[model samples]
Target: MSRISSFVEIYFPGVAQRFQKGIALIDERYGVKAMYGLFFNFCLNVSRPGQVDRLHCLPHADYKNLALAVCVVFVYGEFNHKEKCWLVMWEAGIILQIPPGVFVAYPSALFYHFNFDISNLEVCVTDGADFPTPQNSRRLDGGASGRGSCVWFNQASMWQTAEIGVDTIKQAISQGLDATCDNQAFLDSLVFAKIMGDKGQPQPTL
Candidate 1:
């Protein structure tokens, strides 16, 4: 079993574009939002290579919850954690354009980091439930290979006990499990462990 070191969690919701466009127009025309409301917790790292000063943004450790809607206007950074490497992970729906008048919460986690470069992009974050800290607290200091593992024992058990579909199981694993172990059996064991751990008994096989 792999131990978790550090990780981050980001939540996105579906909304309409017209509403987002109107909010964007308001932000562009008046600049009042930036001055009065909470700002985006992420920063626009212009020093990175191929990073335009006004085209992207990056989330830092300081990303607390704000009170406005926000989206990833653009993405350009190195996923390999190498020097001068730039990539765009989100293309279409991956970059969510949120509208105003919505409740958005940005919780702080172990892997609290993101990158973007854009202008007039606004978002609000607010505090919610108490943040969860890893049992072994440490910062991630490597490339994609350096990601910490995520273990969802109790929840995984509940889902499997309900005999959820395989696709649902896969999706839950992708979101809750560590990204490193993408194999089928490893994922199956994780789900099984989650269920058995909750029941305080050994995992049973058919």
Candidate 2:
């Protein structure tokens, strides 16, 4: 996992630093202890790897939670963008060309995307990840074989997690905030918020 992270950081510098900061922010904001999990969360695939559409081109499809993409070789694939409908970029049903080394960064989870079929010779490798997304990540550093074993701390039971998200707290109340949210839960929540609020002023040296 570290090797893969290093390789990806080669093409996209500051990956480790930026993502490390992002992970910390998520953990802080959501009152959850999270880590990279240090896994290959992307794919290095061939051109037109998926099935072609009726038009014989890789039709408009949205990539969920994608952040960036890079074409390594002669991957000259055309791309089209649509918000909620099928619309070409330049001409009537035409798309924009993607030259090699012309890296693209976008929030794929928020937009619809279209791509044309690439020639067999044009191989591409895309690397991307969503930011600030919350997940129950395991403590990889403390485990043998670096597999999922230990959690940083039981967020639900250990941390002041009732203050994690307002929506979650409300939902918990609506459904059942029981077994947690004891008599002192409200004070604990407020104190937790105050402490975290006072923080984030100075960027801590990692």
Best by lDDT: 2
The lDDT per prediction is: 0.28, 0.32
Residue-level lDDT of model 1, residues 1-206, one tens digit each, is: 11110111112221112223333544565442322112212333333334432222255432232112223222233333231122223322133332221222322221233432222233222233544345423333323321111111111222231232233456757667432323354324322111254668765321
lDDT of each residue in 1-206, candidate 2, tens digit only: 45434533454343334344444655667655443232213333333324431222243433333223211111223332111112223223344444333333322323344543333223332233433222522221211111111111112321223233334545656766542434354323221111123555633110
Candidate 1 Cα errors over 4 Å, as ranges: 1-44, 48-59, 65-70, 76-111, 114-206
User: Model 2 lDDT vs. the true structure?
Assistant: 0.32
Worst 10 residues of 1 by lDDT: 1-10
Off by over 4 Å in 2: 1-21, 25-40, 47-57, 60-63, 66-94, 117-206
Model 2: how far residue 168 lies from native, Å = 8.1
